[model samples]
Target: MDQPRGVESAPVQQLLNLLVDRLDSAEQRGSAGVKSIALGERTWPALYMAHRESEKENLWEHIIELSCWGWLVVKPEVATRSRSGYADSPRVTVANILEVRKAVGRSTRIKSAVERWREAVREGLHGTDEVKAAVSEFCIDMPDRSMAEVVERLNVLPSLVGKELLLREVSSQLFWGMSKVLDKRQGLVAAVLGVDECPFPESPIQLQVFLPESGYHGVLFIENLMCFERAIRSKSSAFDGLALVYASGYKGGAQRLRTHDGCSLFYSTRGGFRQDLRASFEAWLFSKDVIPAFFWGDLDWSGMRILSVMRTTFLELAAWEPGYCQMLAALIGGNGHAPEAADKQGQKALDFSGCFYADTYLLPALHSYKKFVDQEQIRF
Candidate 1:
């Protein structure tokens, strides 16, 4: 009798060849259905065992050994029977087997590709140290500064530097600068005669003044900053005739003046005069014979409204530039646009016979010219 072929040798060789062929074909097809069942769905045993005799060969053990050797292998399948008598069958189609094999190979390739990209990025970042340092510096938090100051400082930085990083680094400095600007403006009224630094009275209505002469007394009030600055600079010329007793600030510019030296500066917190101080200031003005006083502000609707408030306190108050006829003349001389119509409430107010010079001249001019002129515009 011919020597019987060994139980494992021939079949094992054939099986290995078959497995290699199947894996190659699966790679060519590039599908992962077999991997989904084997790895994801765990259907490996069903995929490997072709017939009952293959079970005795311990095919699963060999497959596991192949996996350790770097071959893409399927997981073992576990089955169960439900109360409904339906068997939990695992999918073991040849197509699924090939697909799983291909998927495993593709996954390995993708992981390797990603690692290469990450390494390249790491190397690139390392090469540019200056840029990295600048970025870190910019991201650091700083105190706030004003926009003007920030712009001024950033201009000094090298052009090669990133603007966004610079801005972030100096944001706080910019904000602080803005705050300082506002403080300077606020300190304007008090800075006159070095009075802002002086101590103020507890009551809001306290009146004080600093004059060259001891006996000088008068009621002095400013509506806005530019006009207030002009008045303070020309204090002697402006408040010459009056006793120079009481001084006050109002609106944007006026609220910032200081109350230093002997002069007490009263400013309105909101738009109109402070209620607690209003009557006191008016009484002081009347007592000091400060009637027919000069008033100056912008030549806009809002400016007129401010003048109207002053008029309620002092009937003799007269506007400096926002007079009705004066503004009308200015509007006519310039090639400017017309002003918009006042709303119903403003129209009724403007219709009053006692309306300011702006009401008579500027309002009508604005209606005709269809333009608005601010005080700053006239300064140039």
Candidate 2:
């Protein structure tokens, strides 16, 4: 005797597979209909009508279960009903089915739109009138209360309300209730010198110096904001004799330093370095013979990259604490940690074992299973 076939049988499996393939193809083409199943002419027309009218072909389990149980027979009552009624013509049923499909499609589109809006919010672009106008224009057909309710429900700032309105107008709540979890990290460094400000150009290169009453010049530049803030707050006696100037992301702080008698300011530009400014900066660095200049930044790849650029300007420069193991240990004590090895590209560019400069030191220290020390990790 042959074994009984369950839902897992080869023929049933093949049929299910065929149904899935057909459903996927229809979905991809934005249509609904099954043309692959083999049955009689009468059965085929009925099945096609059922598939098209139901528009639930993607729910293959229900359709396959009904077909396998031979429950797909067209009823007499259904046939008697007019084409405009519940058990109507294939075209009429298809219209209803398409109504459901359209609902689902609209929902998906709304979700995508909400995601875009949330992204704009995270970028601090949500508060603009342009975004509000766009939302108002897009959500015109949405029910007043339904769309307004969604906008109100979002905990985001008022600027994000327009995005919510636009999404609701399109009947999409896909990215709804998700605006609260965006990252808003600002990467620029901020420093406040004791002197008013320095004359830093609006360029990416910022060389700051701090001069104390003792006439010792503490020259440094930073790329990390929190680290810079902490450094200024913790006035080290080592910096007592130095004339310090800071290269900050803002022009006001640099400009204030210009008013001080002996202090100079170097501004940062987004376009790296300008030749004339670079020459003037180098001249300043080499001008004072007895003073030892220090450079400090984060232990990350970007910090190291900046250190590499600074080397071109300062020949006698050395890495401050957090850049080297000894200085880091002295500043932070035994709790100081070294950064992980440089990433593969950094390792190749800076063979850690071969050099001791600011940029090359991190690669070797990291390769030796040491962790990179963040400037923020050091206690004043």
Candidate 3:
């Protein structure tokens, strides 16, 4: 468990960091370039990966340490070889980048999980049989997005997957949102071809989940849970014809589903947008151009960023201007503002030209006021 000093050295870290991106690119493109990282002594990858102070002798030592940790088996004897190793160098890649740290056990654990998940998916299994596979999807299929997070949270994944359909829930927005036709299967027999219940609420949602769900003509996403609960409470009147959902805070993401939705509604934050649900949400926009989707969040720098990020996906994502006006009026003396920190966060201060909210209103007013207006100001 302790990292060897040399292995922990800047040189080794630089080397690995360079390789990580390359490996990811290679894997995504289905290229053979990842088999071995070709690093010449004068090349940028090698120089960037090499430490400022490491000499040739010390460099080889680091390689040995990395090899000892199973990152790559090194062949340090040749000059034609890359800084990490030559094309035909004895140092062959022995494992994945994720496997480098826990060369002994974590690798095996992750490997087993991936294998189990592969088998489970193949067998159309659910529950414990399906949990590892879902996590494995994060670990493998969506590697760039979730591998590190999944690896860091692997121990908790099993229990988390027990009651929550983490993967499938994320699948629509994260993996299947771009779908024209639903291709996945859910539960024992349900394939996501039509109406289903939205899964954002921790409890049962009485509303249906497909696009243009019956009476709901539009969808509204709130950032906070209380707001979502409040919206849901308005089911019979004002909120009718609106599939209201909570964007699940800054940590919102796509759900992986065994069965995918035909048309999925996407909810995301600055942190979750394309990284989490951009594609799926975009697909929804592409499929249903008529449905109006609005994202309402607090009036702050982050809120602006959230709006900006959401706009990239749903160009129609507009400010709840009427509600925003009401929110400001209800404020003390109609004197409005965002947080102090938000005011100083210059990006928030910049006049967001061509903002969907009539360009000159709402956001500019908030910027001028320099104060926070919680969305909860408007009750259900």
Candidate 4:
């Protein structure tokens, strides 16, 4: 009963996957055929792999599920809820992390590496080198593709930015400026979706969504698909929107706004914007008279980056005003952690440094923690 009735949580499984690696690495020399580890209560090795507050919160509820799989053992005599005391030579193994998982509760997500990769390729993510690299580098050690860890590794790859190699159909220098810098483990990779000299449309483009028929104050662009879909359906003021666009995985869907009418504002769900998509945003902002545009994203470098992109160098954007700013300041002032951007696309921390003038004091304090504060958790 400890393991829930259906699918396991992605975050919990991710944690278990990481802990298994640690357990495997720390195995003793003269042990039996069984390879396992010992975990002390109130210690980090027993909890989330990430030492940050945000990650801690994610894996907090699955202690029982892990116990059920024998992946985690708790002393019946000790406070189980506390995840306290010590775990003796436990039976937990790498198999616990790699084993087939049941469809717990509402989740029917498949965690198999082969199956997932096949699905990914079918979904058009088969960019030869990327798919190969993801398999060889990430899954080679452990074929746990469903693990959130693998997903994060893939997200940061230049492939996620949807950039493709350009054939030398023209002078390479002319196409250089079209590239965007993407942060990677080795450093940064300059990504170019298409060479300017190539035929008609160089790359597949997702159009900016607009509800020209809907009456409203402004346009809201959300990073999360669920949230974007919910915005138009709900009449609640908290999620109310005149119109909305889904900026899927930082691929800003806000297309040419000049064709559409301006409202009170234009904003995003998460932080940061790429150069390839900035021109339309610029035109959207300065079209006629300056209309109000707002950006409400997670409280992290990435979110701030999106905000910086929205604010741009020419125009300044206010924090969800005195209210959002005050809330953000309170979180940062308290040392809210800024977890390294899981899939950071920008090469520099201050990718949009020009907007720093408005909130210079806020960045240093926020950046120090290097943690992420999800906007969905806080009640606005």
Q: Top lDDT: which candidate number?
A: 3
Q: Which structure is stronger by lDDT: 2 or 3?
A: 3
Candidate lDDT values, in order: 0.38, 0.39, 0.48, 0.42
lDDT of 3 at 147: 38
Compared with the true structure, what per-residue lDDT tens digits does model 3 show for residues 1-380? 56544655555566665556556556555576556654555333444344553465456556666666556755444632444343333434546457563423222222344554454344442235345344335323343444333233323322333245434444333343422111232321121111253322222212112222233456676776777665654443655556565655432222221113323344422123333244443445445345687767766556666766666555667766655666656543554543554354454354572355625566666655666667776775
Question: In model 3, where is the ten-residue run with the lowest total lDDT?
Answer: 186-195
Off by over 4 Å in 4: 1-197, 207-214, 233-242, 253-290, 310-319, 322-330, 333-335, 338-348, 351-353, 356-361
Give per-residue CA lDDT, model 2, range 1-380, as digits (tens). Answer: 12112345443344344444444456555565644334322322333445464432322333333333442322233432333222233211111222223322321222334444444333433335544433333221123334444433332333233342322222233234332211110010001111232222222233443333333344555555665555555566644443344554323223223233324444333222455544444455535343465656655444455555555445455666433555345333444343333342332233422125653546544445444555565555
How well does model 2 score by local distance difference test?
A: 0.39
Candidate 2 — which residues are off by over 4 angstroms? 1-108, 114-209, 212-218, 222-243, 247-294, 298-325, 328-334, 337-356, 370-380
Worst 10 residues of 1 by lDDT: 79-88
lDDT of 4 by residue, 68-132 (tens): 65555544424345432223222333344434332222123324455554444334332455544
Q: Which stretches of candidate 3 lie over 4 Å from their true place?
A: 1-214, 235-237, 250-289, 331-347
Better of 1 and 4 by lDDT: 4
Clashes of each: 48, 42, 25, 18
Q: What is the TM-score of each candidate against the true structure?
A: 0.29, 0.32, 0.36, 0.34
RMSD of 4: 18.8
Q: Which candidate is the best by TM-score?
A: 3
